[model samples]
Target: MAKRRKAKQRESRAPRFWGQHAVLAALENPARTIRKLWATHDAIAGIDVPPDLQVEMAGVADLGRLVPQDAPHQGLVIEVEPLADIAIEDLLAGAGDGRPLVILDQVTDPHNAGAIMRSALAFDALGLVTQDRHAPPESGALAKAASGALEILPWCRVVNLARALDQIAEAGFWRIGLAGEADMDLADALGGKRIALILGAEGAGLRPNVASHCDALARLPISDRIESLNVSNAAAIALYAAQNSQESR
Candidate 1:
């Protein structure tokens, strides 16, 4: 009996996911394969969850047993496998009406990336492009910051960002590099056929090669009083500018 109990214990020790939005989105998505679910009686009562999915009604400690002690599961936890990453070529091919795409050049911070993703989705941008090596691994913090958008947005990790920009240009995207020192303002750089808003790390801004790859260098029209806007905020402003310009025409 002890051996059987130990076997059951091993089965229960799986990676559990939390966050109401994350779990609910996962549950609603038919493509998402959920392994197990643990929720308090009150929390489960709130949702019209499917009957076929495995469920357990338990206390907070029961959820503690499923996930890390530090996790803020908010009365529920779900164990699921990671979804597959999307391809850049497929994303470009699938572009319906030439919406803008945002490219990250070694912007490694997960919080910044996730925040940028949230903004991207809000502006109805095409998708995101990042280097696989420099970017952060997908985790709870990023997912939380994205507010359920991390799952929906297509983050295309490519081998080289500059090379990817070259591909994007060939695919008919006009690359616009955002740099503080740039002579051209963002609005002046607008009216392009298709824009790839290329950005880089905050202090360093866009690298020389990365800047060289872009068709034009543009700056946000802000006073020189501040050093610079946060990279994610810059991205938001740029995306907004792009959309606003497109709508005006």
Candidate 2:
């Protein structure tokens, strides 16, 4: 009976969002369906709890048991259903501002993916694209890393990344894959056209097949002494470069 109960808990689909930013962001987003809210007395005092939502008052030690070990919950945690998936076609249809889009090629690290989302929002990118089978799902750590951008950014998970690249190309995006070994620098390769900045997982870099789908491959102007930038940092630099390039045009 205990084993069965533990299995059920492990299989639960509801995502628990911890940390002040993650919890507060979800509370404010109208589209987020919050199932339960647990907070310390002091934490609850500052929050404007929704009248219709269920809330539980708990002590700090009690709250610790509810989240992963060593997680900094900041005295709040929330159980919520995953956000509804946005269709790639819908994202393409709504792409009018010429904002660049980011496509992650098997970036499975939740923290990295979340940080990329934060950068995407900071640079006014259209959205983030990941393969449905290889991407990290919305989770507490990811949400915490995103620090509220997860609620604002549109994330589209597609089945076949190569096929999606074809569709994005059909919509007139100039896809540029970032590779450490690429001959051209990012700035030299970018134009005024709408762009899709493609980044690969750390260490492995962009797969050959994915690179083949891009309009061009470019590299950051980093020194050879350091091999590569962390995926999230690289993303921030790429976005900054793209924004500057667009404004200069």
Best candidate according to lDDT: 2
Give per-residue lDDT, candidate 1, residue 115.
94
Go through the candidates in order and give each one's C-alpha lDDT: 0.79, 0.90
Residue by residue across 1-249, what tens digits does model 2's lDDT show? 000011112225788999998999999988788999999999888689999999999999999999999899989999998877777888888777889999999999999999999999999999998998898878999999999999888888888999999999999899999999999999998987898999999999999999999999999999889999999999999999999888888
- Which regions in candidate 1 have their CA more than 4 angstroms from the true location? 1-16, 50-52, 61-72
Candidate 2 ranges beyond 4 A from true positions = 1-11
Q: Please give the lDDT score at residue 151 for candidate 2.
A: 88
> For model 1, what is the alpha-carbon lDDT of residue 191?
66
Candidate 2 whole-model C-alpha lDDT, 0 to 1: 0.90
Put down candidate 1 lDDT per residue, 1-249, tens digits, no spaces. 000011112122343467787678768765556778889987787787887888988898877776656777788788765555566777788665868999998898877988999999999888898887887566655665676776677777777888888888888888999999999999999865888899999798888988999999999999889878999999999999999877877
Residue 55 lDDT in candidate 1: 91
